[model samples]
Target: MYIRKKKNTSGSISIQIIKKIKGKSKVIESIGCSKDPDKIERLLKKAHKRIKELEPTLFDSVKQEEQKLKFLPISNEQVIPIGDELFFGAIFDRIFNKKTIFQSVYKANDKHELFKALVISRILYPGSKLYLSDYLFYFKKKEISDEAIYRLVDSLYKDEVKQRIEEAVYKDTLAKVGGKIAVCFYDVTTLFFESESEDDLRRIGFSKEGKLARPQIQLGLFTTLQGYPLSYEVYHGKKYEGHTLLEALLNFQKKFKLKNKPIVVADRGMLNDANIAFLENNGYKYILGAKIKMLPSGIKDKIINLTFIDDNVTHEINIHKTITYKQDKQKHSLDISQRLILTYSSQRAKKDKYLREKALDKLKAKIEYSTNLTKNDLKLSHYAKYLDIVDDCKVEFRLNHNKVLQDSKLDGLKGYLTNDTTLSHKDIIEHYQNLWHIEKAFRISKTDLQIRPIHHRLEHRIKAHILISFVAYAIYKEFEIKTREIKKEYQISYKILRDLIKHVFAIKFDDGEIFPIKLSEVQQKFYDALHS
Candidate 1:
């Protein structure tokens, strides 16, 4: 039988052809037809009672082969080229292409050695210099030798690199933030060397980290509170921290013309009569830490007589006030001072104990093991004298047993010697606290950026390396600022942005086909946002 209705143009019809035994109906076979009904009826007639023929049909399979063979036109919007703004090891593809920034750096310095130093920071990277040749350029396609790299790295000094970086930062920052309250900060650290050559620049000096008996180089750093570097200088191996202060301040004044005297802030290491005198005579204001030991006996008596008052209501703070005096033996005069404030905290004392124990442990271990002694051993009585603490111990376990247990606590009372007596004690303490950020910046430089042990024997190269570090630091600070400045609605953090960028993948096609190799959703959005 044939039946026809409103021939479904918008839909499809399916017919089944099956075979069955006599009176015993079973779906032995069924053929489904979604295409032509005429063909389905013809197929059903061919089916017999004993045998079965099942045929299946549909509109069509997907046009996959056609898709595989035919090329799709790629629009300009479809192509995403990798831009060059890479930083912190190309981990970040920043707004400014790193190639452009690098070229800018190169232009500012305009020296092959300085360029090589920056590149070394990228390639040499701690371990085996395996990919050194890949980065080399060929004037006539000749491969440069590893000897060339050694010469470049060896010849590079800290001063040349530092000068270029300083100039670059000044130019770039001034162009951007121009004549801001760029609070320049000063601090010093010591780097000890393994070599024993008493060269003019490298001498056995007092290490700020108290690396006594180890020949060291004293480095005084002047940087803005924002981590923008202003100037840096290396002093005699044994120059006192106090001694570098006047020079550093003088250097800052000479290098960067301060139309208005900059308020220089320093820690206890910079407190001295000469430094104070210079600050006053030069029309400079300073916030310096006071040395409790430097105060006279009369001051000590006055400080003990000082009184304390509670200030927990208004500012949730405690107040203590005392009067102190300093006696200059050389001048034969007493400098009567006022306002010695003492605040007590158990937590602070505990922290002091912890750090002192840590430093004492390290120092004691070094002093106990005196092998291959250097000539500078005589000048290290501060820590070297501690060696007698382990005198009874034998060769075995000397580093552990005799030295490790010696306990010492840092000085509890710290005094601030500031010419500006008008500042409330709390304000003075808060300002001094800002010094930690600078110290932290130095720590990050030494640990994260690996700024230690002058690899270049040349004094200038040493200076240049430090200068380059200053630039890196400034850039790092800018990165941090930009990340923080991003609107909360964007919800893009530096770490998250970094993660998104890592998701972006580079695809290379042998047949010149353009496609996404791999990209996360957020990364794609970020890429799109940049383009937008």
Candidate 2:
């Protein structure tokens, strides 16, 4: 038999032998050249010389004793085995996990790492501690401690991380959306705590979501055309939402060193006449929600008679526009009427209906339980008492009760007051609606970044914690943007990108060497898109 061999890209060779040939010379020639080129050529020559001593006649004599080349029952399954190269293209990708990203940030390569780690951690495992040891051992198969990770996360809030994120967002959003605009949307939401008692900064206040008098940190968030965070103020939990706008804007102005007079858009919470007049007198144009109940009868009558467009509506209103009204003449003379755009969405009504029904069901269940039990057994008597006996009625249970769906009609109705009237009404509504992005940002910060009650009680640490979360939100936002751009076929959300990063492959070799591969094309593409 004769054998032919050749090498391929895998650093391995394919060998084919013609074993049917006659004579010991053919056998010897096959044996001599069949030696691998990697080893000494002399060894193959010696082996071939020794094999030549055995004659083909000798093989025929031994053929009966040779057991006829069993061939191991050749099967295709065993013949062409699967190799790692079929799916995995690189080793670095198999090694990538949350730990790698954390370590990369922990090394403090950029101010953005703190944010990147928090964001990646949040989207991967929400409301969970991202320990460095677990990250290293499971992710990189190395040892890293909790203290080191904590310090790295803490450092994100120190000097440049927070400032840089704020700077980057403001610079980019402004550059992307440059035009005449006005009255940025301003509102505050509190991130409540489980405990009612903490520090003054964590005191219980009026909960917007009606969270049970729990300690919360008031987050005053401001956004404009694109709904990107322009500025934010973390207030004491006990502060009022209505009272925060002017101060927040003032702080924003001071921080940004802004002197341009810009209009402000605010909710009804900031509706005091004094506040409105103060904004106008300071050369700042203002559009604010006017509570119908608070307005004089004349203005209320005018509002009722005023025709509203079936579609979204925008009208230029100033103190000048209201001159014909007796109420406006009596209310203020220095104010300029800014544009007032009113938008009503049926979707909001549906949402409101859902909320009211849910809240009412809960309230009804509590009231029914309280009435069925003795007053002494009821720990929730105060809540129950308010629900029962409306207008001195004795408690009665019936299958079809006249349960009032309280505030059902206005359940989903949302009102936006904006001062920038130049933009179309739809544009204004769209801009204001983008406020939900802040809610998403907060979810990631609280649940993903795990920035809550907090670990360190020191004020600096608390500030740092918030700063890290802020940076993380920035990173998360950046990822969302990049992923969308790269995976244009569908939305590549933060969760999907996060999962791809965690996926790993193990590589094994005959020499006892093993290593992980890096990210795949999809993964590297997404990561690169984020930077781009």
Residue 440, candidate 2: how far off, in angstroms? 3.5
After superposition, candidate 1 runs with Cα above 4 Å error: 1-84, 88-164, 171-178, 209-213, 309-342, 349-413, 484-532
For each candidate in the order shown, give its overall lDDT on alpha carbons: 0.52, 0.52
lDDT of each residue in 1-532, candidate 2, tens digit only: 3344545576644443334545443322433233356552554445445445543556676874542332234332222211112112111122222343333453544423333444444434445345433433444345545665566667655555556555555554555457434546677777776655679677677776577567777888766544555777788878877778768878877666665655566667787545665565556655566453344545434444444444354343332333221233465444345544444456665775676556557656755777554333433442233243423334542322222332332233344454454766576566655555656656656655556645455455556556545544554454555566677754665556455666634444433444344657886676566545
What TM-score does candidate 1 reach? 0.57
- Which ranges of candidate 2 are over 4 A from the true structure? 1-133, 136-184, 194-196, 259-263, 274-278, 286-294, 308-339, 343-427, 447-450, 453-456, 485-494, 504-532
Stretch of 10 with least lDDT, candidate 1: 310-319
Provide the lDDT at 402 for model 2. Answer: 25
* TM-score, structure 2 vs. true: 0.56
Q: How far in Å is the alpha carbon of 362 misplaced in model 1?
A: 17
TM-scores, in order shown?
A: 0.57, 0.56
> How many clashing pairs does model 1 include?
21
Candidate 2 — what's its lDDT?
0.52
